[model samples]
Target: MSGPVWAPPEPGAVDVHTHVVPPATSFVERLTATDPRWARLVRRADRDDVADVVVAGRLFRTVRRVAYDLDQRHAEQAARGLAGQVLSAMPELFATWAPAAEAADYCRAFNEWLAEQVVGYDGFYCGLGIVPLQDPAVAPELLAEIGRLGLLGVEIPCATPDAPLHDRRFDEFFTEAERLGLLVFMHSVGSVTEFDHAMAGTGAIFPARIGEALAGLIANGVLARHPGLRLLASHGGGGLPASVARLDFVRGMAPPTRESMPEPAATYARRIWFDPLVFDAAVLCLLIELVGTDRLVLGSDYPFLPVDPAELLRDPRLPDGLVDQVRSENPRRLLADAPGTKHEE
Candidate 1:
């Protein structure tokens, strides 16, 4: 068989789903020394080269240098043909179960650290600040600070302890994000306890959780109400495209679903953006068929092996133009449209 048609990426192509961590020693020292409240809530296991962060009793192990080492990350980006990497705090750092004020402080520190990491790497690095969604009222102020710090947008989880993202309490935050043109990069890392049992063995259930979260957002009219919101769903939108037929079937048969959702799930799915991390040619083709080329962007889940866009781009099934769009044009478009971003012509 012939090799896949290839196309060079445009300058400044972006990887939208990478993560960053605060310097382990400094983060632990700052919280422990300055704030007793946060000190009690966080724990650390420090090794020579890496640290394991335990927040609210959940362990995130072995955060490596690639998470915060700019030289290493830049070298990796250069090797992978990425012009920029969009950085968000690792999802475990959210700590939404803490008291609202404490959560805000934790999120603030993470955001500040992210801002510092992105400094001097203007065109090659863009940071997505974290917000304390447990306190919805505080989100707007934090988002404004993110913009002030020259970060690109905000990264939020699919669900919090209190509610899924569609709940009315989050309406103000979503509205502000839409009004400001912020890119709402929705990611999931199994924060919900019920999912712990359901997702117990293999990690398969994590992506499914993302699908459920997207379903809630669309069914409850969040996407409809805020059309301008630039939402990007992680992990190939978590079974969303594959489930559309079933969802549409439910839309026709279920009275409550029909009443709540004016359009089919596939209609709303098309409105949102997704990363090309599905890792299969057939599945990627299905995603493009369902969501269209314009809505898909390259994502590597960087510093993590197994989800490589390079392999996906190598699939002979993809057209050259479609490959080009996923690698460059689409991501550039997403960034250019983000609120408070200074798009260079």
Candidate 2:
């Protein structure tokens, strides 16, 4: 392997990749203005036809969902599957969280509701709170309070094309996040400037656009600036692991070194972590090789991705020890290693 080989996690270890939809966030209530199909579902939580997904293939019921509300889902997860998931966030972050200007109250109410769940629940759940990136200025305090509440982290949307991850002003968010040892999760969203517009027509551009944005986060200095911040990219970190050879000018050479950036191939591969929900082993192997198994963590993209977390966690191709590491150890270390977790050096 190009990087140090890591061990799989022990039973009950930390799972940093699973995504969840806490009841308090009322994620089911918010819909993006761009996707009206989603709007109807928010209004009707348990829709038979309302099975819109927050992640790729996972669907939401008209009934509100709990981490393990579905016995089939739990049976799949309980085999010591992906440690935990980042749940669906409160809907307000999206442009369609509300029909109009009454959104502020909805936002406040949802945050309080989320707090109620995180504070009340135990073992089976962990919280990744939400913040409205539209008002980036207030994000730090939001993150700080979430941390104080002992939530796992905060979830923010992918950077809009108009607002790339490299914007240093957003550093305040990362800065406070770093101070509180909060994790910043980047999931997909809309911007006046989209990284990709499926609405424009056709193409699997989401993966490609994600690659550009995330690579910018690191190669462009976002990671370097907020050294203490911890971030997890959704959807296989979009496609960074797969794009390396292109960066190296190898098999599928890249377009033309967009910026004077480092051969992001090895750099990104080694730094950013990804979830195990990737449906292929060859890609999983390559990610392990490029990013090193240690940086790679187990992610189920649960309540979203259709695959069972256990099966993905135990990918046959991934070495056994490495699978253990991804399941829990790495996440435990990531969070416990954070300055405030009270872990010893």
TM-score of each: 0.84, 0.69
Candidate 2 stretches greater than 4 Å from native = 1-10, 22-64, 67-93, 96-108, 190-205, 242-265, 312-316, 338-345
- Write one digit per residue (lDDT tens) for candidate 2, span 107-133: 444455554553322244455666655
Instruction: Choose the strongest candidate by lDDT.
Output: 1
Which stretch of 10 consecutive residues in model 2 shows the poorest summed lDDT?
1-10
Residue-wise lDDT of candidate 1 within 13-38, one digit each (tens)? 67888987666556556665654323
- Give every collision pair in model 1: 181-339
Give the Cα error of residue 331 in candidate 1, in Å: 0.5
Runs in model 1 deviating more than 4 A are 1-12, 25-27, 30-59, 191-202, 254-259
Best by TM-score: 1
Alpha-carbon shift of residue 155 in model 1 (angstroms): 0.5
